[model samples]
Target: MSKVDVQLADVSISPVQYQAQLLAALQMRDLDKFTQLLDHCRVDAFSSVLESACREADCAQFVQQLLQHGADPNILNPVLLQTPLHITAELGCYETLQVLLCDDKINVDALDWLGNTALHYAAQNKDQDTVLALLEHGSYIGSRNHAGDMPVSDIEPETLEKFLNTRLKMPNDESLLFKYDFLVPPVALDSALLKNKLSDEKDNVIKKLSSPSPEMDPIVQISLSSKQQHLLLHPIISSFVHLKWQHVQKFYYYNLAFYVFFVLLVTFIILHHHITAIDEHRKSCWLNLSAVCFFKIIMITLLAICCFCLIFKLLFQVCISPVQYLHKWSTYPQLVLTLLTINVLFIDSGTGDSAVTVITLFLAWTRLLLLTGEHPAISICFHMFQKISCTFLKHLAWYSLLIIAFSLSFYALFHDSKAYIAEKNVSSKLFHNPLISFFTTVSMFVGGFETKFLPFETASGTSHIIFIMFMFFLTLVLLNMFTGLAVSHVQNVQSKSELVRLTAEVNAVFDIEKLVLGNPVCIHMWMRRLNLSHNAVIVGIFKSFVYLWLSFSWLQCFRNIHHSVLLFPDSSFDYANIVYPFGNSVNVTWNYRLDHKVLLQAANIVQKKNDEARQQLDCWAVFESYEERLNNIEASQLRCEALQQEILQLLRLR
Candidate 1:
């Protein structure tokens, strides 16, 4: 009989006597006999000797002895198509896995029949050491199995967050919040691997299993998830982003400089025009009228160019993260600013025109902050402000009904407070109209009790009671609620400041990538000869600028530049051609031991993340089985009821 037929503890009487002895030694967990048997035994594809050794926690020493003699650590069982490490991982044999990992020749990331790495099994296991060992050994965290499930996708973030790092000063990497594709350019979309479609029957099965809610659809989830940004705390990813940041800095800075110049010129023109229109003496004065017109023309031209650039950049940004770009509150304001600027040429000099110019100017200043978001500090502050604003607005939506009720009450009750208005001489139209009264109510909440109601005449005691209740509600309840909400957001921001800063760094880098490179073309960007690619790079840069003016959007004429430069060593491009600013020559990841150590640590972190997703899927399978069994029992019950009804009908006929 073949060695595969041998039972775990039941060793049969066979001619290959060494196989029986080896099985006996492994079952007993004997180190001495196992070592002696290894000298006579050899590594074979069909042999389950090494696979059985990894099943026992105490057999690590024997497993190491087998590897030292002649047995392969990476021997795959023909049936399961999994290596010994896969067995160790699935069984949570921490000691056995530790022994296997020590072998320099071991394939730590060996794939099984399902295209799953040993780390994928490790993630599903509760053994922390096994997962950590695989990660530190450099099992790629971003690797997706044949089912399109990433290792990290199995582990829920809430569970992973519990044990990740509670006490130590080790920072939490929030960048893992997003999928790998967020930073990855569209180059992978062109890859043939993603183009394959599942069979129609398989699609139908997925649809039946999936929730009927459209929001839960995979495409909808992907779009929604795109809005969630990340804090790129990983050193390898951050190193790449820092390089990209340098490439795009010049274009961003140039835009800022031109904007600053234009804003100053607009301020000068607005002030000069105001002074001239009002002052009789200056209206007829020809002192620098020609110069004023010259600057006005320059301002308009500069503003027009700025508008075009922003629109073009926005278009490219949407292509990278479509949902994210559209949902941003800043997007609407930017669009409005561009439209107002276009109308400026035809607008007449009057109050209507002044209002439009002022709105446009206000929007222009806000964008200044958006432009400066490339800096880490600025990006953190901006994100903090944005998050807090969202939180505050959520509360405001709930409180708006109360504010509206009070405003309408005041407008109705105080409509003809004739004696009070005449006595106070409050000429500001404070509460006479709907718009004015609504704002007055809001201001009262913000600035404390408005003393203007001291002498207000009321039709009855009911009006006085309403006024008192409104003051109490605004002052005591909603004000404190809003204050507490803001405070909580501020405290949270302070706690995750480092992670948020890293997130901003990632966004800044991506913005630059979209602005400069646009997208990858069919041809490889790596230049063997400097002259060939250099000309292509120059032409790409020139075309990017023209795409803005030609169509007020990013419409590339030539081929796209290489995105591989932004991705660096992780990308498909050869690593030897790259040179980075590694200050003081500490250690190189690929060329030295430092990167090897880092890869292992990164792998360990990712292994823990993938732990729960597979477990959840297993539970879903169990639920489906129970439902099927219920359906079978229900069909049997209906048949029995029909037979009883037929028997009753026969008795009635007799």
Candidate 2:
């Protein structure tokens, strides 16, 4: 080769070498090498290489340095067809672009080779955070790029819409332009042929809805009406909002019953104490017979009231819903408090000896469990457990704390008691033997209202142990029964929730039948307005109607009566006969069964009717689109005519 040819080859290879070296510097992520190279290269000459580097990796810092050193910020790299900033942004080098954007000399709104601005690149990448940053920097959102696509067009329409809607709703974002821009764009005009096409779509919808899932019962699915919203809301209403006069009456009666139970319980304890006193000749003979007879009368009266109230409460709760159960349950602690107060008032005689007073106080203490729902007496013991280092240690600590508290409270009130006033009575035991006090206190705490005398072989030690065992057994049985009830209730709730889900699925797939009688929506809506899910069949019958009215009236009477007691009756647990506990004729067990039969049939009819209404609504939506398009066409034509008139006027003026 000639020397002139060699020089020309070197000249041709120089640009390629420069480009490769710049790319290497960028690939190395060495900011300093990039600065030195860009300082030497001409703006227009190296623009292609710079843009290519930006495209391959984040080169916003390099681009900014070059721009500050007098490289043209708006210059395009012809080979790669990208601007440096545009490529940097598209690659999501957010911080690099942030520093570059700080330079006032750079044209922030400059478009890349693809006709996309930096804002367009950000939106296309779904980088909303970057898009907001670009907008904040005064990037022109409306400006079309080389491809005639605006920055907004780069955004996913749905995401953009949601963002804009959120912004519109914010009090600080009062943008009239945004409001006008989203005024639901009109659909393109469609002909009669298009309406026929919609009929085909309706048929498709019907077919899609016709097939029932194998998991769903086909018979039930075919029967539901479309208009039935979930009736589960009924339970929520009863729980929170519907605290009717019925609830108030039940509370009043419950409180009265609880008062009677308290009185009887106290009398029973006092009688045992009196008998012990009589045996010891501690009380005067005259005081003994009077007190004993008074105790007996109190016991009998209390039992009668308890029975009456229990029966009343059971009658009231028979057809109630779970939601109403929660409402009624909330009143229990208050009722209990009232009962406890009544016992305290009658028993707090300053003349009574420690034996009589202590027995009365301990019986009253048992009412503390009723305080469980209102305040967490149980939680106090649990909290102490948390401070313990190990699991078993925690349990041990909790039981220790409970026993200690029980002993302290028992001793504080009953230290002077002389009955079975064991060699270690409250005062002596509390001062010298805390362990003894704990066991004794636990025995009394566990011992329920059943403190009847059981003749043991006349040995004091043997009798004491037998009494403690009886108390433990009684407490355990009551606690176990409560736990069982709670478990059963939770299971019932789960099953009911699953049943509702199945019902909803069935309703979604149901078919419709035309009725000559009337509009099903009107019928269904009327039912909803009446709030009559299970009240109908009961309301139809005279006996059931009378029973409901009586329940309401008795509730009113309870409200009016100053001293009437309420009793809750035990409900049947049979699912088929179960009654929901809210409203007239609703029993959890009974209403559920009734609802299963009647609701299924009624909902099936409603579902079909609702489906037809929904289809009509869909048709209306299409019609609305057509009318909007016509309005837009007419509006555009008017604007064009006005523009033409303005031009004529300008010409005349000239």
Candidate 3:
């Protein structure tokens, strides 16, 4: 009898012998013998053996016969917890895998002990045909393995190409036929694998399943987290903080409206205070004390809330180093306003009526103008002023010494003349006071002198001569020198206006980022409180309106008027161009920049070629690795052959 026939004949006699017979029939490609052996043995007793044969022999007919005879194709191995499909995919048994897939009972996405599916194995092995077959049989592409990697992620370029091409070529109509109805199965741990239940292996498996997937890009994850955290804070300011520059430009009008409202409210409060002071001065009972106090309280409360917002912003700026934070121009004004607010809140109410308080209020109002720096006219004016101030300070040291010498010389010569002018009531006493004499002399140089009030007739001739020289030096020489310095600074600022404007915008964005987006802990706590408040909706709406108003330009109308004047100048009127189609010739410059366009196109083409070359190199590397693995397998097979020859020689000697 043939070996397969003899094995089949003895199948009923022994379970082990029956499995051996079934493997022999599959290896020989004897479909009849394989089917007969399967029939003789119980389905469960020989199903695993049939699966092993299918994996090893590359026999599709044996797998099909076993499936027809009621062998469970989805049966997992006791040791590895892997199904026959996983084995076939790993071994590159494409035909056997196809046969197994035809049976709907098999779980194609079944996870092995490592949480890897059949498709993952196929991709890992770079078996293009097997990958395509698995994909055609409704395999999920996004299934993640234990390593948090999708089947196609981090694979060889050649294998990735095969996967992409197969997906692309799949017809829309045929896709419905292979639609997967995915249902995750509970993981079943093998008793042999998990013999010691308290071992680290169990904990490892649990941790693997519980951990977040590493498939997300790190940058995308961080951006998403930041967005979520911001959403939990004050949503309106968060929106403004994250707005694109183009959108911010378009939305400036809304912000302007907010600033106007804030300024009007402040004006109303100041007027109320003035009226209250007038009533007290006249000793009239026109205003009720209680009503005035209540009004003051309401205004103070509103100011306090505004101050709180500013303080929150300052806290965020604390993330930056002290020197860096102090370097910003806006920080100084903000700090002053914050300190003024704190003083008003903690000190006596009468302090708000003091001259210092009034001066501080005026400063706070002026600081609001800084928000309009985005306007070109305002930005240029500010740049010019800053330059002039810096230049003035650089020259102040030498100018001070010259003024001091003239003042001391005049005071010494005119000291005795004060007695003679005392009866005339001409205030010649200024010469007796050193500090006052210095100011009076400087003022006289600037054309503040009144000859009727001066005792020049009574003073000595030396004093008169010294005063004339001082006036000439201070007015003609020093005044003109300062004027020339200021003019030079304006010219320098105008030449570099665009650079200054860009730098201001960048600095503004950095400050806003520090204030609005920094301090996650504070934002989180404030958000929590905001969420719990009953008036949150009304407060949010009001806050949004106020914030939008503050962000807008109060002088936008004037800026627009300036822009119009520049566009249509009275001196250089282009009447012919205005009447004709070509109103302005400036747009032609944009089209003339062909060099830039050509350079951009060349860069794009070069980038595409580089990407293609990199892909080719990756494919070559994969092939080289495969060749190395094949060489190792061949060497191992030769060693086994030599050992077999030695065993035969030992048997012959015995």
Model 3: CA > 4 A from native: 1-244, 249-275, 278-295, 319-323, 327-330, 351-355, 374-377, 415-428, 445-452, 519-654
Clashes of each: 9, 38, 5
TM-score of each: 0.51, 0.22, 0.40
- Give the per-residue lDDT digits (tens) of candidate 3, residues 248-332: 3433544455555555555565556556656463233334456656666677677667667667657647542344577767778
**Model 2 quality (TM-score):** 0.22
Q: Candidate 1 on 1-654: residue-level lDDT in tens? A: 333333333234343566677888788877787766564444542145777788887888888877766567778777666899888889888888888899988876566656567878877665556666675565544444555454554443433333232211212332112122222322122122111222334243222222111101111122123222221334344434444555455656776787676566555545555666555544334454676656665766775676677667667666544555678777788778767756653353322458887886787777776767657767767777888888878888988999999988878876655323556565444677887778878888788545556335565676778778887898788888778888888888888776666566556555454444442221111111121234766655643433333343243332223332243313322331232222334243333322333334444555544455567777888988999999989998999999999999999999
* Stronger candidate by TM-score (1 vs 3): 1
**Residue-level lDDT for 75 in candidate 2:** 59
In model 1, the worst 10-residue window by lDDT is: 522-531
Cα shift from native, residue 149, model 1 (Å): 6.4
- Write the candidate numbers in order of decreasing TM-score: 1, 3, 2
lDDT of 1 at 539: 51
